[model samples]
Target: MARLALSAIVMMMAFIAFTEGLRGVGPKKCCFKFNDKPVLENKVVSYSRTSQRCSNPAILLNTVAGRQMCVRPSASWVKDLVTYLETKNVAGANSNL
Candidate 1:
């Protein structure tokens, strides 16, 4: 009886560990959206096309305050925002030169 109880406890522990491991295996879903929001403009410090952390193709924005936000790359507004930032950066550089 003691041996049966020990085997059952071990099986339960193994099952729990397996379930936890399964839960941790996938990337968590993100619900970020840029719709109806004002342009961040100069607030964006940097942007990236490729994201190693996100499961989907996301435009990752690093804000001036060091906060990170993920936006959908396929969104037209996101593309326009990136273009605006690039143009602003170029104009700023030209003024300095």
Candidate 2:
């Protein structure tokens, strides 16, 4: 009886590990290098923050040309871009009202 219970527990642990691995539970997008050049605000379609699991936090910019660029979040250009995007979003939302 003891051996049977131990086997079942081991199997359950293995299954859990297998499922997590298949699901890709870790960060898929991480930024190691940052683009120093400032992108035109109009060219950027959207932006997202890198996963917290990443060693370096960065801003991910999605451009109109469907390119992704990583930039330091603390950079002045990044701050300006985020502010511009936020204002643009607000204006767009207000226009729909």
Candidate 3:
């Protein structure tokens, strides 16, 4: 009886570990439309894998764009991201198509 209980406990532990730890359900990345074209400039990043948080450069950095739109993500955003290299779209849609 004791051996059977021990076996059951071990089995339960294995089940829990497999379900929670060994799973590989990471964030998925996909393309998004920007400036009338698909912008794939940023690499697919996960909240857990990113070394640093998502941050915008200082207002000084955007001095060239006329206005500064500096906003940083406070918390980790777990989701998909389109890599710049993989995403590409033409400027004019009617002519290109």
Candidate 4:
């Protein structure tokens, strides 16, 4: 009985350790570079910002063509695109009601 309990405890600890390591899912995705060329707002399917933990914050745009582009958050085009997407999402959601 003592040996069985000890083995169970060790197995539980090992399982916990393994799960904790995988909790992050994978490495933190950080954008090291950015695209300068502007993309058409119509081509963008969605947009998101990089993690705050990232050293260089950026805007991530997912295009309809299945390509992801990283752009500087401070860019004028990026700002406009974000605004357009926000309003578009709001309108789309309202229509579903």
RMSD of each: 5.9, 3.9, 13.4, 3.4
Deviation (Å) of 58 in candidate 2: 0.5
lDDT of each: 0.74, 0.94, 0.33, 0.91
Compute the lDDT for candidate 3: 0.33
lDDT of 2: 0.94
Model 1, global lDDT? 0.74
TM-score of each: 0.51, 0.77, 0.28, 0.76
Tell me, by lDDT, which candidate is best: 2
By descending TM-score, how would the candidates be arranged? 2, 4, 1, 3
| C-alpha positional error of residue 40 in candidate 2 after TM-score superposition, expressed in Å | 0.9
Lowest-sum lDDT 10-residue window in model 4: 21-30
Q: Which regions in candidate 2 have their CA more than 4 angstroms from the true location?
A: 1-23
lDDT of 3 by residue, 1-97 (tens): 9999999999999999889875555423222211222212233221122222213211111223343222122321211121221233233444577
lDDT by residue for model 4 (20-88), tens:
989796436779989999999889999988888888889889999999989998999899999999999
Clashes of each: 0, 0, 4, 0
Model 4 residue 2 CA deviation (Å) reads 14
What residue pairs clash in candidate 1, if any at all? none
Of candidates 2 and 1, the better by lDDT: 2
Error of 2 at 63 (Å): 0.3
Best by TM-score: 2
User: How far out, in Å, is residue 33 in model 4?
Assistant: 1.2
